[model samples]
Target: MSAPATAAQPSTFSRFLAPVLLVAAMWVIQFVDAVLPLSFTGFGLRSWDLQGLLGIVLGPLLHANWAHLIANTGPLLVLGCLVAVEGAVRFWTVTAFAAVIGGLGTWLFNAPGTLTVGASVLVFGYFGYVVLRVFSPARLAHRLLYAAIALIVIVLYGGAMLGGVFDAAAGVSWQAHLFGAIGGGLAALGGRRRAVSA
Candidate 1:
């Protein structure tokens, strides 16, 4: 008797639907922010304010304006797709870890009274993950990928750091960037072991 037909593997688009849906949901909420005077800041438990918990999950979706949201969407979309490709389980794991750690990093390291906002921390985390994934000793890729990541970091963050030094009001949270990168590094190390085992 013929063996039962195996189910076909889903297409790349199908695999990516989860992240895409999330991105769309974020976009919709951003639009809602434009029209509504809603702020979660005053609604939750006093001890656990907006910046404490909701900020970790919802902060990425809330933006200062269209330009800010646009600035973040591209990197988020690209890196998120790559993470999902690693497998749904790993994708969610990295995302949840990055968001929580990045938020806590902001809470702990940010200057007191400073109102931190935006998804840039998570963006940096995504970049960190990519770097670790490429540079891991067990990865099946050529050395060029690792070199490219190094070059990208130097060209991008290096310039941003130097610029931050001169422009005091640039308002970019280099601390969040730093902590998110560290968080991503830790997550990557854990993920690397899984890759090696696989």
Candidate 2:
């Protein structure tokens, strides 16, 4: 009898494939923007465009340019790993919640008539989730995680925030950051409550 066919090796596409494909798509969009200079506004979802709402949802998958995407890549990989560990269901739940809520917050409060684009809001939301999870009282593991996240934030955003107070180009929306952080905190708390009830 012919030897039993070994189960097909899992495709590389099965591992990190989703996120990789997503990042690749983002890169393509950015590249097209560079070559064609397509307006970043209303990429076919006008009424739903809802200003930077697209940024909150599709933002994580889009970038201002290669440099901007590159700057975000490391964090995206790290946070995506963490969420993946949390399992697909919870991972998607946290991400979707953060994006929707963070986007809504930005839409409600961003400078009038100004449309924002990019995944900075979702990125900030991931950062916030990491920060809150590390500090959440749900588990000892979370405490350690929180401490590490705090260190990262201090290392990354501490000086940037101070600079924003003085620099004009630092017109970064502190609001998006604030709401993203809030969404993360809320997600962590909700997760903790569910764990306790269970």
Candidate 3:
């Protein structure tokens, strides 16, 4: 007798695929940019230029250079996975918020025609979401757990988070960091409202 066909099982790490894909794409883009003689920074977000607005969507995916991407990789994987813990859908959603908010803020605030690029925007977004979420969730157990996690995230990234927005370092886009965080806070509030309604 022929054996029945078996269904494929989902991997435990499937939820992490989105962030993994993001990181992988970053590495690939950097590699290609490095190998080619042409630079890709021109494709990054250009402040106050209508023609450059497309960079809002394109900017996060492009980085200035290997050093920039490398600096962003670790915290991204950590906080990104934290966001992904909700699901891949939420992960991408938060990323969208971060990109748009970060993009618009930088465009409006930075020197006209200035360029910005990198994943730090999403990093700040994810950080804000995780911290803001500590107040949400219906159950005490969940709230407490979130509180603990939030505390840990604070200890680890709090300095960088504050520094990113307030440091005013040369070549840094505090606008991206600030708006990214605002976007993340909005996402958390939106989720809380949904939970309340449901």
Candidate 4:
């Protein structure tokens, strides 16, 4: 008998699509803001303002500055691609949870009128999902792969991730980091359930 055909790996284009769109959007918004002499940051998550509630949708798209967006781009691509390996559906589901949860947390906990912006919420959330996934009840092989990937992620970003949440410096919203992680955990568990059911 002929050998069974293996499933195809996710295409590079498929993996990169979402992240590229996200990064491109940030850059385009930044470009417009730079040329117009108006800061788009006010559109970010502003605490305690009824109108600021809109930020829950817009926050991740607006960055404080070029430097801020640049800083988040790399981690966003790396971790976002990891999630994308499962396809866009999973990637966006985790992203929605992260942004909504992270944004709400910041809105409730961060100082009123403070403008919180950056893709760090997504970055931290992706980190949480990637790391927590190792402990999920998937097939042994899948879990082992997750464990290896998690270990590598930990060694690279562990300290930074910890500092991001608990040891946040001034101007950083620890609430977003902490809650984004919470959201990521929720996604990981949700994903595991779906996987097992399938």
Q: Clashes in each model (backbone N, CA, C under 3 Å)?
A: 0, 3, 0, 0
Which model scores highest in lDDT? 3
In the order shown, what is each candidate's alpha-carbon RMSD?
A: 4.1, 5.6, 3.5, 2.8
Q: Which residue runs of candidate 2 sit more than 4 Å off their true CA positions?
A: 1-19, 41-55, 135-171
The worst-scoring run of ten residues by lDDT in candidate 3 lies at 3-12
TM-score of model 3 (CA atoms) = 0.92
Model 2: ten consecutive residues of lowest lDDT: 40-49
Q: Which residue pairs in model 4 clash with each other?
A: none
Deviation of model 3 at 187, angstroms = 0.8
What does candidate 4's lDDT look like per residue over 22-125, in tens digits? 88988999999899967888888889999998888888888888898898998898998888887888899999989999999999988889888889999989
Q: Encode model 3's per-residue lDDT on 82-165: one tens digit a residue.
A: 888878888998898888988898899999999999989898989988999886865999889888999999999999899989
Root-mean-square deviation of candidate 3: 3.5
Residue-level lDDT tens digits of model 2 in 1-198:
665464444343354554455567777877777788564534411123454344556655655557767866766666655554555555566667666776677667766644545555555666666666764554677577668766777587656534432341554555555666567667777887887678
Query: lDDT tens digits, residues 155-196, model 1?
Result: 765565344334525666666666666666677888768766
Order the candidates by lDDT, highest first: 3, 4, 1, 2
- The TM-score between candidate 2 and the true structure equals 0.70
lDDT, model 3, position 65: 84
Error of 1 at 161 (Å): 8.1
Cα lDDT of model 4 overall? 0.87
Candidate 3: give the clashing pairs.
none
